[model samples]
Target: MSDIRDEMLRTLDRIVEANLTIAEREKADGNGPSAKLWAALTEQGMTALGETDSEIPFADAMALVARSGYHAVPVPLAETIMARRLLSRADIALPEGSITLAARAGGQANLVGVAYGGTAAHVVVADGDSLHLLQVTNAVVHNAYNQAGEPRDTIDLGKAKTIDRKPLAHATDVLIAEGALLRSVQLAGALSRTLEHCLTWVNDRVQFGKPIARFQAIQHAMAIMASEAAAARAAADMAVEASEKQADWFAVAVAKSRAGEAAGKTAAAAHAAFGAMGFTREHPLHYSTRRLWAWRDDFGSEVIWQSKIGQHMAAKGGENLWATLTEMN
Candidate 1:
């Protein structure tokens, strides 16, 4: 199993991620992830990596997503994986091409900020009590990009009939929690990569007859960045494990909140350590940091998930808080 995991990671790093050049990312920002890349991913069985029928274990699937974050794949790979998993559990046939989830319904069943919304062949959206699977060919698509230059568009399902529908077992809030879990894991991977870049830059950059990494100030910043990245990775690991066991939404909320906080702190520290170069497009640091900023706000932001955790704890009262947290451990 470890061998398989290592091989999988290598394939992603060498094949899927290595080919995602700056030019490819620029093209992806204008058009969606290239069809060739998608085809390559499909051939690797990555599109359905987490589905019920997949031979890959859930933990391995989640690992793939985290690696994607590290590489800043700039594709809807994570979205498509989750979409396939959701549809499979609901006993729906997986659609061809890319699939992505719509945001939790906002009053009128319109899903906005959908990853790959502009190009996805199908979208799974929350509609009343049902999860509506809509074919995107006829829907209204407003093409847009997130702060990270990833495709995040609005799709209005305007009178479209559901190709297949299933009763939503969980509330919209639960859906957000699930999305948060995914984003948290992805953020963890991005944060880890950002820290790596910062460390590399500081070690190689010399000033005042010594490497910047030798300075106390830079050392302190690097320590903070590494700690935050570690925390994010731990939180994401907790979320993935809990998800595999079918734990409640509270566990997911905790993971999302902690990871989001870590992402913000780590991004700031990394940028500070890298100095002006980190901010430029020529450097790849922006790729991870920008995605961290965008992803931390996606699903539910840190504040939102923190509120959910606080509210639940408050209702449980101060006395039970220790027990509740310990139980998770």
Candidate 2:
């Protein structure tokens, strides 16, 4: 398992180094992840790393992506992984370059938008319970702004022309639940990067004739950043484990709730500790922090996940919730 994890990390490093160059160029061009980077990643099988039928350990995959996030490499890691899972379940060949997968209608329906959806080669809409597959072409897409300033668009199935239909056997909730977990993993990566940037900033920036990191106030801030990062990692790891083990939805709820809150707080602390420099376009800090802000709201926000978990606990007689979490691990 360790060897596999090392291999995954090496692969991730190669992808990041190569894509970092592209990301820099894209920033110059006022664009995001380039087509070439996406093509290269797909060619390298990154987009297909964790298929629905994957045997690779979930922890290893999550760790690999966490490292990727540490470098702020611009790739659609979460969306691509979800796309692979959906395609694998449908036995459909995965598309190349900039694909987005959505699970909605209470997970009964799954949708894929290609080339960022509007420009994708094909879009697959599936009704998991009914085993229905619908192919839509030239998907109608809508621009949606996120905190990261990256390109995000929505696919309108009503405007899509159905090409084929098939029956699927899995529960829709399964896909939705998996997506939520996958999102948590992505947030783990962003959160880790934000912490790294914050620490690096504190160590280098001098204050009152010494490194700011030496100041007690700055030390306290750094401690909080570290604590939040640890919590976020734990929550994300639990979410990934639950998804891999097919655990109860309650586990997913807890993990997402904890991770979402931790990520937002961590990113906020990181930016605050760095002062004005962190917000500048010249620094990479904003990239990770902005993405953290966006992703914390993805899958399910802190409010939604907390409410769900609280409701579950209340229904379970509100007894020994802490014990339940400990036992889940």
Candidate 3:
């Protein structure tokens, strides 16, 4: 496992370097960079990493994506991985670089203004008690906006073809859990990078005859950011482990909820530390902070996850709540 993790870290370093270059170019050109990065990832077999039936390992895969978040790479890791996993379950072969997936809200099939719909080849619709897979061949994809100035859209899937089959046992739940965990991991990475960037900036951009990082207030804020990043990473790891083991859904919910809160708070703290510079479009900190905010609201927000966790615990009764957690671990 350690060997695999090390290999993934090395791969992630290469990916991050390349992605940073591409992201800079894309930002200059004013185009969405996710598609190009997705093509690169597909070449590297990223989409297939955790989708196989042979007890596929996910730790390395998760680590790679988390690092991608650190660099604010625009690739759709959650969407692509979820699509691959779902298609694999349904015995569908997803062509590399040709398939895209995204999560939509509101339990309605024809709703618009969801996340990352413009470049998607397919959309995963999670309605009540059922999951619908719709191909976006003829769908109208509007060039909607997200925080990073990335291309999002309101997909019109009314005329699109659909699959009526029921998903694999607990498939929707697992996908949601796994997607949230992945997003959380990415948020942790972004938060860590932002905090590091702020600290480095303060150290070099001296004020008052000394580095701003020397100030007690800045030090405290940095400490909080570091602690929150660690907590988010730990929670995300727990979610990933639970997903790998096919543990109870409550574990995933708890992990995701904690991670979401951490991501939101940590990003805000980092931005505050960086002051107005972080808000400028010319600065790179906004890139990470914007994505952090957007991703936190994706794949079941903190409030939603907390409600789900509470409901699960209540359903299990007070006596069985602790038992459920233990069993999941």
Best by TM-score: 1
In model 2, which runs have C-alpha deviations exceeding 4 angstroms?
22-32, 90-98, 106-115, 119-137, 161-171, 245-248, 320-323
Collision count for each candidate, in order? 0, 9, 0
Give the alpha carbon lDDT tens digit for every residue of 1-329 in model 2: 59988887787778767766734634623234556666766777666665656776657766766776665555566556665566666666555544555544544222432224544444445455532233444445554446676545566666666544444555456555666676676777778778778778889998889999999988998888778778877877777776664424776777677778887788778878988998787787877887788767765687887897778788877577778878886
- Higher-lDDT candidate of 2 and 3: 3
> What tens-digit string does per-residue lDDT give for candidate 1 at 1-329?
57778788888887765467778776775467767677777778777666767788778888888998898887788888777777776677788778888646567646677888877888877555566678876565577778888887776677445799887666355456667878888998999899889888999999999999999999999898888888888988888887873325877788788888988888888888887888888898888999999999988899998998899899999999999988875
TM-scores across all candidates?
0.95, 0.85, 0.86
Error of 1 at 290 (Å): 0.4
| Global CA lDDT computed for model 2 | 0.65
Q: Which is better, 1 or 3, measured by lDDT?
A: 1
lDDT of 3 by residue, 71-186 (tens): 77765665566566666665555545434444444455564644456566666655544556767667755666666665566667677667444545555565566667767888
